[model samples]
Target: MIMHDAPEQTVKYLSLLGQQFPNQQAVFTEIINLQAILNLPKGTEHFMSDVHGEYEAFLHILNNCSGVVREHVDEDFGDTLNEEEKDNLCTLIYYPHEKIALVHAAHQDSPTWYKRMLDQLITVARRLSSRYTRSKVRKAIPHDFAYIIDELLHTHPDENNYRVRYHERIIDSILETDSTEEFIYSLAELIKVLAVDHIHLVGDIFDRGGGAAKIMDRLLSCVHQRTDIQWGNHDILWMGAAAGDAACIVSVLRNNLRYNNYEILENDYGISLRGLVSFADRTYRGGERIDPLMKAIDVLLFKLEGQIIYRHPEFDMEDRLLLDKIDLEAGTVTIGDETHPLITSDFPTIDPEHPYELTPEEARIVQKLVDEFTGTDHLHSHIDFLYRHGSVYLVSNNNLLFHGCVPLNEDGTFASVNCEGTWRSGRDYLDFCDHIARRAWRDHDRDALDWMWYLWIGHRSPLSGRNVKTFERSFIEDKATWIEPMDPYFTLTHDPACCDMIMREFGVQPERGHIINGHTPVKTTSGEKPIRADGKLLVIDGGFCTAYHPKTGIAGYTLISSSRGMRLKAHEAFRTVTEAITHNADIRSETTQFAAAERRIMVADTDTGTKIREQIQDLRMLLDAYRTGLIKEH
Candidate 1:
């Protein structure tokens, strides 16, 4: 792990490692050999950051020729009793010395991805001519590879008609056009054909679009085929919502299964639409239960993961393991974890006996989402939930990583009030109108769960309880002044354009990374862009499926790094910021202008010119909306 193993050799080894192994064990074995051949003093710390779901990468380091992992091939090490061998099996791969430690790191804190990759490694080994691990060492067998179709509904739905207002967005090569619709559709298609070594979905497979049902169906089919990498919160919201609306959903499920030629007896199958009722009924059958209580508590703490929903079988005061597994305390809900947040009585429901109150519509949405998740996925409360005990702390490294907010809670309060408030760093703000929506849905007065908090942290509603100007003004009074202020839904695209503004309030290292985030919704889709909040931040949320277009091949992200310097680039889908902004702006201008023209006719100062002007206005609106939203110029 010595930092200096001849940078050239290290680079060459990386290249070979990338090529030689299609799984983790093979790669790690190579790493072990490489370290031995290099013969560097042991104990040097080597950190593998964010390996993610890269199965081959994992394998390449674990089992390969003359590679670098830990100790391997007892024959290669000579079986000589050395002090290092006596102490640690892993460290014996090297010369055995202090000042060196090899470690692996991930952006999101969860070992589920690592475990899944480990499974893939085992699978690859099993399929290969040579075995990577001894037969005695094999403890687990993977069922299948994960095939995630992100934003499935947003993709090119078979039902899509060539009805886009923009000429460039008319089907073929719409990736270049400027519509949100196009962006989503394009991401969906592109992900299916990405060049990455591996692909995985981190969650949010539903909501905010007309194609929710489509995405859901596609996801179900995909899960049936591949491993479920990330079970995001949107999935939980829907599961919760479904619980209150299972009757209709169950009917839909039954119809869908029947259409697929899958027959069920007694309507109690795991994949049944009435799936939720039979399951819920079992968990709540008066008193005694065979499964963990979380299995029965599916109606609360809704979640989706491992292609299943884990509700409590029934509440048990002594069974803390089930409760601990439920993740209601303070852990971060990353892509792989199996825990879920608890829907406690601490938060009110719409019922008269509930702790809090909610309007009818808000109540309905929550009920529907919960039920949908549990019924469809069999919501399991057995997995760990988000922000249970983990505190949020900001890191100076890794491109100034921060969730959308300024690291503060939505109520302008200290974020660490609870485990949920624990941020690594940075703040969390309630986006525009989501807080209102949350408030409407929740019995007002309940602190939001991580799912709701995550959604509103950066984006705002046009009707959020607070105003943007006022929100921004708060930052002027304290260290918090560095944060942008906006109510729900009020877009902040233009705020960052007023010359340059400093992002770091306190001092940071020279190596401190640049800031990057995913929160703000897309602006005009054409090229030229408007900088917001003085350009201190860049929003990378291309409405990423779960919102507008889930399954389209138009999804990608902005890459920001100090090593790369201050620049933004899109991958696979939209190619650049100018393309996205210009497209978005053009459409908005057109829509605004058309609405105005329609009204101008009634106020006609000059009736003669009014009709012609209105027609032009309508044309301009139609043209501009297309011009902005589509990525045609790309």
Candidate 2:
């Protein structure tokens, strides 16, 4: 080969790449490894939305990978294992430590049982790991069992009789050493790890249910799994509170109190409510039998909300400024043209002339709560994690994932939003909102912090698809006034053209890309479908919050996007973890696959493949540099 002179910049880049490869042999070997990986089947991507703090259900669904583990179990053992055996095996996989104890308690922890389960688990793990490279599989294995797992997974018993004896001896040694339980636990966790290559939380990992903090803790603990979150409106509220937004702090307090989810604030997050408890006790007593804390928080919430509306008139939320609409004398509030009787008229904290102004005590309490919210390290950590892994929307593997709608006009056009002095719409608007959220958290900008509150409830906020009827529901007796009108996007999204427009605006190919959303509970009881826009969009929020189980008629939804295509699983309510561990009860899921064809998608067809190809190209360039004598090999 003739040596060629290279450009200075090109030499610089190739020389840097040479540090990792160092030699032509290393470069060529890596090229072969990456090329082989590209031909393997693509890893499974699990998508879940609107967890709403239901930690038990979310945990179970995550562990089971929305029934994908069960599918594998049934597929691998349908001919051999009975129904009872399969169910037990799945439960074991989900909660290994607990299931093992239960088995031990039942006197079923015999060596025979250990060998059988190890054999079965090893087989399933091998099948699951086949899609991944040996190095990737080794990395997923627990440190203590890395050698054992790698050996068991690679050794095919059917390939040779000697391999069977080798695998059996390892299991027997584990059984003899009384390490069966620990080894099984490790394998079970490894299986769970390999079941889903990536996790996409479409949004709402907070509020409604009491386990928001628990849910955040769980996600934070997932170090190995690739996970991303799309910010949900409810999530934005908590993020705002963590950034010390008074309106958001008051709103969070009110919602938690109203839903009786105070434990999450007091216990899980260590946010003190003692001040509010005292304030409520002294200021909110009346003929109404509602909890005084609830009443107090509601009054405080409205006062803060009114202030925000007045401060940001561009928010177009004057309709929510109902504090001044109250007629104390008649115990009624005028909404639009109608006057509705008030449910409670005790307004010791409100002044008719300055109704949005907080009373001296109210001001003190609100400030203290804001201080507490921003001061909590746990809250900040969770909020920081949210900011780190989350955005307003994400485009991954030709799918658009967002917690809510792309705000739209009634005529099926993207709605324009004014952020500061500039107007943005569609994807631009969402990007602006996402930028503000980060500024609120990272820089603690006052305006950005306030924008966080707006994102939670502003009429045109893409995160909040509907006008929140909090005030009406709190004060007005007439249910008509409490009907929060959803944005036109909610209705217009049913049109394929509208979804295509959204996909195009986000720079995704409309023909193959999907808009994945959450926020609105799909009311299956009312004959509603989660799939809309001729399958261009999927709303996976099937009510993970137990409060919505009645309306949604299901536990929740988890979408599995694999090489085989997208499949939606509507899950039945997961019974308590205790029941699941004790009685082997699982959340039964109904799977619906919507694929145009059953083409086995390989790594070469995915975003990961695109990245690997780039790496290969760079390596090949380095190889060229070496052969051409432009760069010397190590």
Question: Would you estimate the TM-scores of all the predictions?
Answer: 0.29, 0.97
- For each predicted model, how many residue pairs clash, with residues at least 3 apart or on different chains? 200, 0
RMSD to the hidden true structure, all candidates: 28.4, 1.8
- Give a tens-digit lDDT track for model 1, residues 404-454: 334333343222312233322222322222232234234422233323322
Cα error of candidate 1 at position 489, Å:
14
Instruction: Write candidate 2's Cα lDDT for 298-370 as tens digits.
Output: 8888888887778888888888888899998898888889888887877777899998888888889888888
Instruction: List pairs with backbone clashes in candidate 2.
Output: none
Q: For model 2, what is the alpha-carbon lDDT of residue 376?
A: 90
So what's the TM-score on candidate 2?
Answer: 0.97
Candidate 2 global lDDT = 0.89
lDDT of 2 at 88: 92
lDDT of 1 at 369: 40
